[model samples]
Target: MSDSLERDALKEILTASIKEQRAARRWGIFFKVLTFGYLGLVMALMLGWIGAHESESASSGPHVGVVDLSGPIAADGDASSQLVIAGLKAAFEDKNTKAVILRANSPGGSPVQSGMMYDEIKRLKAKHSNTPFYVVVEDVCASGCYYAAVAGEKIFADKASIVGSIGVLMDGFGFTGAMDKLGVERRLITAGANKGFLDPFSPQSEEQKQKATAMLQEVHQQFINVVKEGRGKRLAADNPDLFSGLVWSGESGLKLGLVDALGSVDSVARDVVKVDNIVDFTPQPSYADRLARQLGVAAATTLGAKLEWQLR
Candidate 1:
């Protein structure tokens, strides 16, 4: 009889535990629903606020073209030529826009990408001769970045900012010795004799070295020509090493005639542009987009947890 009573007690405990788990699960579902609902409401409110702000600003005053050239200036990067050109076009089309500002923060990337943007900026400026375009360098603007900057009517920078790395670079690794040591076979074929000149797995020939040097020299000359065209009479021709892939601080850059003035974005906007109010024309990711991204991450985490739980 005592054993029977113990079994009944054990069964009752198990049943009560199951009930508790069920209740907990219900609460969990409720909390998740509430959390998602709250996020949705917040997103709606943010969108409303942004729309209202845009409307109010549009009604109030003239717009300024503000294009953010952040990150490496590559065709594949966020600071792509297409995106920058689109922003510039939008600014140009805006009847209330007085001037265009290229806010640059980049170390640099593809020379081709930078050249494309520079040409576009110059063409646009020429097309809209009445509108002035200014460049404000932030943090670091070097190499291809400075190339684009010279397209601006005036260039401004912070005193300590890094500017000017006026040169081109092609990086590669040679692993012929390492591959030989490891008994690895390199299987590479090219149509042209000099096509694989910079191949790492193969031994470099004297002819290849000469060819590569000549190619780099040609590219360097092109870079120097672009700089000359952009800077015009401002750049001192005395410094032979100006285009030798060297960087300089904002102070030295100013002395070298790389930058026009030393000032922060706020100072330029308030003092130089002579407008107290400013509108950011740079496309910012919306809050809803950010929230959706966060939610996607959270969902992925939850899915991963579920998979782990199932595996366990």
Candidate 2:
């Protein structure tokens, strides 16, 4: 009887131990999964997943709706025309919005993107005539950025801010000399005569150069015309280089009529918009968008190698 009792006690203890181990494992897995989820949420919030939702305000009182136009303006870039247009639409459509402020700080990029944004802003203004639009420049607003800024009713900038670079450029490099030193021969094949016109690995052609220059000049002329139409009589006709792809300080720009006044976002929001409260309406890129863009870049980089042979 004693031996049987001892055997039963041992069996019960073993079963309880097994049960405890399974419970411990379950809790451990649950906590680890919870930790990983928390980390992912924090990372997403830091990367602007949450900020995108806060772009517009649910205000009932009059306030200035601000939209940031920072960094290079391009179709694939953060300052894309689509994002800007969406933000502008929201700001204009907001019932409590007194005025819209375009706060720009960039060295400019992609004339096509700038032109699209400029046209869209004009369309929005025409549709919403009551909501006044003003541009406030910080640091630099040159080339394409200036093109978009002029669409505003008035442009304000700090005294030391750099503004204006009304021009177009197509830049590249020639590696023929280096290739010759490295004993590399380029074997370029093309079906069309002008298909390889600007290939840097080949010899430069006088006719091609002339054609490229003319094309650039035409683009530059278009930029000049846009500035002229936007600034109108406010531009200083005395400065010959006003549209010569030259930049100037904000204070000098005021004298040269590149800028209307010297002020900042706060000042413009308060004095021009007649509201001290400024709500940002810049469209924030979500984490998924950012991830997709990164994936696109990776794919492009892989394809870039395949196109390396076209350099010839």
Q: For each predicted model, how many residue pairs clash, with residues at least 3 apart or on different chains?
A: 0, 0
On a 0 to 100 scale, what is the lDDT of residue 185 in model 1?
A: 96
Q: TM-score each candidate.
A: 0.73, 0.89
- In candidate 1, where is summed lDDT lowest over 10 consecutive residues? 303-312
Q: What TM-score does structure 1 among the candidates reach?
A: 0.73
User: What are the per-residue Cα lDDT tens digits for candidate 2 across 54-155?
Assistant: 654555477888888988776666787877888889888899988998999988877777889889999999999999999999999888899989999999
Strongest candidate by lDDT: 2
Alpha carbon deviation, residue 146, candidate 2 (Å) = 0.2
Q: What is the alpha-carbon lDDT for the whole of candidate 2? A: 0.82
Alpha-carbon lDDT, every model: 0.74, 0.82
Poorest 10 consecutive residues of model 2 by lDDT?
Answer: 303-312
